[model samples]
Target: MLLRLLLLICAPLCEPTELFLKPSPSQTIEGNSMTLTCEIQPRLQTSKAQLQFCFFKDNGALKSGWNSSPELRILAMWTKDSGSYWCEAKTAKATTTIRSRRLWIQVQRVPVSDVSLETQPPGGHVTEGKKLVLVCSVAKGTGNITFLWYKGAMGLKLGTKTKHALTAEFEILTARENDTEQYYCAANNGFGLSLSGLVSITVRIPVSRPVLTLRTTGAQAVVGDMVELHCEAQRGSPPVLYQFYLKDVTLGSSWASSTGGASFNLSLTAERSGNYSCEASNGLEAQHSEAVPLIITVPTENRRDLLTSGVIEGLLGILGPTTFVLLFCYCLKRKIGRRSARESLRSTSSPLPQDSTYLNSPTPVPLQPVYGNVNTLSGDDIYSLVYSTQLEQESPAEPPRTLSKDKVSLPIYSKLKKITVIDMDYDDAV
Candidate 1:
């Protein structure tokens, strides 16, 4: 019974517990060496044990096994070397022990050398005879590289170099309309060939020699007349914008050819009677035509009417003051003449005049008709003269004789009574 108890304790103590590998989670590149070691727990002297190292993939397939060694060595590892492995040992008591741990291997790969190409001033209708440059660059890779340029299907070998960057320049001298096509590039580093994106190029042809033609809607332009002046380039490409000018000032503008030429018109005015010109441009460049003088004449009859009206207005403005002065002077002269005539009438009709001593005095006088009659005065006329003389003496400067007698001879006074009735209608008319 004691022996059986000893055997049971010994067997339980001697059995293997767990197995593991050193560098437990290791990794390595392809075409490289890797080492896997098996280790047992409880400080077992594993050198005395018969060891077996076995490897398997996670998919339950056996890779390889060794029955005599605890260590596994992999030389020049490849993708197929990547698997889980374990170690087993057989002791002198014939008991077998297995490792619960697993081993893994990793492989590295080289980078690919692929490149792309691009061009500036990218697409169609580039200016003709202009220099164009293309750039080629590697999109992926880590080695010496060279670039090759190609036009359509033809390959143009550029220089080879260790640098991955390269540029190719092509000058199109005197480019024709037909020199346009698709272009591409390739990058190579002896390992492989990589192609870039395709680019299309078109060389633009400049417009032909422009010819400006001037045309008018009418035979002659008159002032204030609506006229159309057409400036056209007959041979230019279509859809060109044009601007019209008169004497350096812009009148208006119009658009025509999309590809090349245009026409602009203007309505004529008196101020537009100078050299007229037009300019055509198509976003790229502009050109101006020679000046064409357009004369706008005014008719002689209309000019004469304007001059006559000006003269009449000027005359009226100058004559207004002179006429006012003349009228005032004439009114004053009529008043003075009437006053003198009244004075003469009063003196001649005075009393004591015919055979009096006053007639023998030194003052010689001529006898004139008084009141239109040579008369010896009646008593009433004598009294009237004496009374007027008295009144004139009372007011010396403003005597009654100073009153105008001509006013009394006016048509207004003809209805009044007169001392002598003379048929003097003919004389008054004269």
Candidate 2:
């Protein structure tokens, strides 16, 4: 009987007096639901036994009154819902209350959103050998975000950054021409991906000394031939302007919007033979090329042709009129000689009809006095005038009976055949 009484006393102590609170899905998400339950260590004696349960978080009650239900439902937990939580269990007739140990609940946040990419300098331009910085930012996000930077549509990965801050930076020690391209960034917090807009970058390089080349069809450059001036910069940006020069005089200018070389064509002349050069610029420092000498040559065949033509033309111009004048003078002299011969023939053949009788007499006869032209004298012609006078013997007594006069005149001959026939004075008897 004493053993039975001891068992009865231990039986009351064995009844469940502890309250336990358990949560389904111990790890919670921001938009998910969770359930918390309050229970005894063992099963309740009967369903009719009146029991009450209530929930508390961070030492604050979740509800004003306890509920008959053992389970508490928390729908849509947020980041702020993360804290310490516990539950209390009590009987309607008993004055004793049981409490469970405190449990910590943590709710995860959403992924990143509104991601953007920017640069240290406002514009997208960057000079060579200068520093370049890329900044990626998130407008709204929680937790550690992984940021990745990409270049161009081919998605060439530049860099990656993981941090809890709103923004991240990636820097290039020295920018170069190869670094010029389109860039973007992406942010991910293990939930969803966010992409930023593209940012264009251009790296400017100073123009290098250009190379000038002269192109021609033949081996040697000649006058009146077309020559091409090709100017190229091995390293420079586009939109470069190339200028051609001859002895410091500007020939022309060419603009290359997307190429490294520009060309200018010229029809060469003798005066164009000089030192040729070129310059290249892209809105930065300009560079000049070395001067190249160009000498024009004349072909041997062409020179010979020109000389031959010039000599022939000059002879024709000078001697043509002179030959014509000489021929005219010769013809005039021959005509004058023929006229003189005709006049001489007429004078000798035609005319001495009046002297026919005198010509028949053997002795010379004096004719009436006649004057003849002195210009008609020939080698056998005679030209003269003579006078004859006679005196009587009575002249001593009478003082000369008026001296009897007898006058005779003879023709004066330029060439004398004989001189005995002609006398100037005559006596009474001779």
In model 2, the worst 10-residue window by lDDT is 350-359
lDDT of 1 by residue, 1-430 (tens): 9999877646643765677766422666555677767666764544544345554456563445545566666666655556665555545454555645665555543343555666556654566666565666765543345666777757555334345333334334454545577767776655667787777877654444345555555677776566565655543334567788777898888887454455565565555778877876655566788887778876788668768977988998999889999999999997887666555556663233221112223343433322333233333232121111111122335323333335223211122222433321111111
lDDT of each: 0.55, 0.76
Would you estimate the TM-scores of all the predictions?
Answer: 0.41, 0.43
Q: Candidate 1 versus the native: TM-score? A: 0.41
Candidate 1 wrongly placed segments (more than 4 Å)? 1-115, 120-126, 142-146, 150-182, 190-193, 200-210, 223-227, 232-239, 297-430
- Candidate 2 lDDT by residue in tens digits, 53-85: 889999689963587888889877777788998
lDDT of 1 at 144: 44
For candidate 1, which ten residues in a row score worst on lDDT? 383-392
User: TM-score for model 2?
Assistant: 0.43
Number of clashes recorded per candidate: 11, 5
Provide the clash count, candidate 2: 5
